[model samples]
Target: MKPLDPRLLRRARGARVFLAASVLIGVASGVLIVVQAVLLAHGITGVVLRGSGVSGVALGLALVVAGRALLVWAQEVVAQRAAAAVKSTLRRQVLEHSLKLGPVWLSGERSSALTTLLTKGLDDLDPYFARYLPQLVLASTVPAGVIGWMATGDLIAAGTVLVTLPLIPIFMALIGWATQARSRRRQHALAVLAHHFADVVGGLTTLKLFGRAKAQESAVRRVTDQHRAASMGSLRLAFLSSFALELLASISVALVAVGVGLRLVDGKLGLETALMVLILAPEAYLPLRQVGLQFHASADGVAASEEVFRVLETPLPMRGDRTDVPDLRVSPLQLYDVTVRYTGRDEPALDGFDLELRPGEVVALTGPSGAGKSTALAVLLGFVEPERGVVVAGGSAADEFDPIEWRRQFAWVPQRPGLRLGSIADNVRLGRPTASDDEVRLALLTAGAGELALDKPVGEQGQLLSGGQQRRVALARALLTNAPVLLLDEPTAGLDPDAEAAVISGLRATGRTVLMVAHRPALIAAADRTVSVGARELVNA
Candidate 1:
């Protein structure tokens, strides 16, 4: 996938202040560099020991150095703020966009890749923001400032430096183009490696049980080894390119040093003028070199972030009205000729399946694997859109409705329980951030999991809880939400008899519209209506 573009960041709404501050820092950094150079050339090299007293030069150098230090500090501080702002703005957009795209887009993409984009990929932008960005600004401002000053002191020196300046960017652009391709591949490899390793580690116990642990280990090793080789290949190219650019910069600066020395010996130039040429030439080239090096450093970030930008640019699969949509607590939901098809699949999962669900009704969709039970719910949740039809909720077409408002009426619990590393109370609060202690406890009790509250931490992904307990905790969150609609898929698949009975009772007492994909006999037996899906159609209740 193409990473998010940096150009989009330039258009971020809340970025004006940070952008302006970064610009100001760049200006200040440029001014300070010039002032410090002039102070060194005139204050110490020319007027200090030659004839003039220590008072003027001493005071000037001190002020100039102080200003330079402060400017550097200010530039760094502004860059950090800008980087953070950029990260948060982009990240929020990604998350919001993902909600709209849902499983339609995500089913084909790797979760590890998405996770990398939000975490490690975003973190990589910090250096670009803090170091390279200020330099990008200084690269423009400092060079022009030096050139203008050069026109006043020595046009020949200015002309020479300007002549070599274009060469740096040209070489940099060439390397950058090549590096861009490599960076993209390298990033892809890293994502693949991360996905493979995460899967292998999580399934190690299962692999051992199946007597395939050695094979799995070998597979992961091959993936990681390939990733390492790809990374080193990219690193080698970037290093060679940087080395070539640095050698060129060194040559340019050395030429200036020689010219200034000869000109001074011939007395064609004064001590201060020669010193200024010596200082300004390198300072001017330094920014250019800095730009080139910074570009090198930002290559990986550019490659990684380009994909993020693309995600932000992708139009959401389901678009909603900017305003709120009415709740359908009292009306029926209708699906008209809806065919749920995975993108790139020749055959649709649910072909022209038509159904209607009324208020206070609990419908269960049952069929063999891949019969589109879960896909149907995914479409209703506004996570995926149908390829051929519409989902009407309570007399309103879902396409034209506000997705966020419509989803606000739901208390969704997916088949798997995804709990973070937190307490039992923390798990339920995700459904409703404002839930009080008593409210959370009540919701847990309602789901038959109140005993878990205030006693232990729900380990990573709630590994501490049995499968049944995990499902109940997730159910508690759904209950706490108290939405008008409830959608679940294979919720009690692994639960014992007692736990399954508790869940079935809770489902019956929900007293609202419900749609679930069930395989459990208890759940199906308890459902108000059961709809069986066949080869390519749904058999109505």
Candidate 2:
């Protein structure tokens, strides 16, 4: 990726404004640099050549110092805002894209990797935008301004600067190329380490039970050691590059200083001009030197964004955007020869599958494993597209309805609810954020979780809850939505007999259109119609 990727400014709204501000700040800093250099040089000349008291220019010097300090503070503030804006924008974009990709796409990816990318990967971009990017702008504007000013005073010193200034960038490019590969390697190693650590920690209990915890410890140690070594290698290269840039800047300033000294000795240059040229010479190289230092700090962030962009660029599957459709609550839905085949799989998940769901009817999809029960559910939820046929809702094609609006009609409860770390009420209120405590309590009672308190904490993925409690809480969340249609997958698979009977009874009493994948006899018995998927036909049971 380029140091300042144009795509970031184009996609992130606040970043464009931040860049413009950075350029303006750079110009102001440059002007101050020139003003301060000239004033300091004049004061020195007065004291050395005219034997004047320090009081003559002390106030002017103080004012200039104050102005420079103010500019530095403003620049820092703007840089921090820019970094925050860019990170927030990118994080949002990545998450939205992931959601759009649907559950099928996510199934192939590791949860830990996705989590790390969204959190730590995006966070590392802070230094790049906050520090390196501002220096990049300053590197361009400040040196040019300093050189232009020096030219008016002494052409020879200015000409010397012009000659040696190019060498700093030349060396920068060469060293940057050498360090880039190493930086990328280090970033990859760090990502691997993070992914492995998250995976191990997430399943630590399972590892302990299986007596593989000791073996996993050795694996973790190996990856950690590899990351450490890679980090050291990257730092060594970064230090060398910094050294090269600093050495080049120092040499350039020395050449300019030598030219000014010789001119002053020959009486062609005044003391003030010689002193000003010397003072401004190092300032000309300062921005570029700083850019080199900051570039290394932001390398990991840049590498992480490369993956972000890749995901963002992936094509989304076609879905209808039209919002006009009859009320799904009373609408009859029918699948006409729907077929779905996932990538990298030889057999079709759903082939020529057909089914109809009527309002207020409970339909159960029962089939062997991999017989397209879940795939059919995905089709109804607008998460998967069928290649061969169409789904009709209310005598109109499903494709004619807006995907987002269509999804709003259904309350879905998956086999695993994918609960976050929060209170039980928090999970229930997720689908209906503004739902009152009374409404939540009623929904919990309806879903047979009246015993669980709303304020009770559910640890990550509802670790604090038993299987029955987790399912009931998920059902409560679904009930909170009060959508016209209910789609559930294995809603009673893991529950005890009593809990399972209660769930089936609650589902039957809802009087809403219910579509579920179920293997349990009790759940199938509650359904108005049971359809088999494995026989390439719906066998009514």
| Model 2 spans with C-alpha error above 4 angstroms | 47-54, 177-184, 262-270, 341-349, 386-388, 422-426, 429-457, 521-535
- Candidate 1's residue-wise lDDT over 339-436, tens digit each? 87776789888888777888888888888988888878878887777889998875568878777777887777787768888888888888898999
Off by over 4 Å in 1: 1-8, 11-19, 28-55, 103-107, 211-217, 254-272, 322-327, 421-457, 496-502, 520-522, 525-528, 534-541
lDDT, candidates in the order shown: 0.78, 0.85
Q: Please write out the lDDT profile of model 2 over residues 1-541, one tens digit for every residue.
A: 4767777877887778878998998999999899889888988988888888777578878887898888788888987887788889988998898898778778777766777788888888888888888899999899999999999999888888888888877877777676677767877777788889988998998999999999998899999999899889888988988988888888888888787788789999999998899999999889989999998888878877877887888777677787876666788889988999888888889999889988999999998988999888888877888877888987888877777887888889887887789999999999799999999998888787888999999998899999879988988899889898889999987888887887888877888899999998988988889888866566565
Per TM-score, the best of the predicted structures is 2
- Give the TM-score comparing model 2 with the true structure, all chains together: 0.88
**Poorest lDDT segment (10 consecutive residues) of candidate 2:** 532-541
Cα TM-score per model = 0.85, 0.88
